[model samples]
Target: MSKPPLIPFSTTLFVRDTCLCLHVQRAARALARRFDEALRPLDITNGQFSLLMSLNRPEPPSMSAVASLLAMDRTTLTAALKPLERRGLLETFVDAQDRRLRRLRLTETGERLLAEAVPIWKQTHAAIDAHLGEAASDRLRAELLALT
Candidate 1:
């Protein structure tokens, strides 16, 4: 019987060192945890807060658009929206122009909640930036954007 080839634990040094997906996922989870705690008082999770902020823009986006922006699938977006809709923080309506499409709109309560959450978000953002340093943080954000 021939002996099997020996494989080192870290056989691929480059792959081990530069695993962007794993690093991004770990960092994202950590950041989400911090934001979730900060936004708890507003009764929103980090994901919900991001969805609301995306919807807060001048144009009320369709469900598809919102999903695209969040990089979520329709089913995932639907699941996320249910709790917000139940909490009266958001409303979905059939677009008049395109009856097939559903549009997401922030409710009055949602706006109020977002307003309350903004200061907390600012605090979180500032703390992160301070920890990372302004230039380094900005560069990190730019690099992340480039990857996306």
Candidate 2:
């Protein structure tokens, strides 16, 4: 089979400089890495911490609801839940009224873990905000939310 032509270096530079998605994704990965390193002592990743925090609501949320809130698909959310569930950090049970529906709740352990993660999150977030400057940080957050 014939080989396909490679993209030009100029195209790479253009995408690197101008692609919003690329920039956002790169920033997201770096931010996630920072959080992951900080949370390593707790044996959790940034995504896991976020997942657990989302379950901190007053009532257990259905799988679909949690998935929607996390901006994750059902399969991805379910996969993410596995380790936490195995650790007894959360539980999933069939809904009483709807057997086909499953709901998620943070266990006592999960709550405790989340409580521990809160201060760490606060510290890291504070550093980030400070680095970006208070006004810039707030503005950046507002702009990102607008995108969503």
**lDDT top scorer:** 2
lDDT of 2 by residue, 13-58 (tens): 9988999999889999999999999899999999999999999999
Worst 10-residue lDDT window for candidate 2 reads 2-11
Q: List the candidate 1 regions with Cα displacement exceeding 4 Å.
A: 1-7, 12-16
Candidate with maximal TM-score: 2
TM-score between model 2 and native: 0.92
- lDDT per residue as tens, model 1, 56-109: 978689999999999999999999999999999999999999899999999999
Each candidate: RMSD to true structure? 2.2, 2.8
After superposing candidate 2 on the true structure, give the runs of residues whose Cα lies further than 4 Å from its correct spot.
Answer: 1-8
Question: Could you tell me how far off, in angstroms, the CA of residue 55 lies in candidate 2 after the best superposition?
Answer: 0.4
| Model 1, CA-based lDDT | 0.91
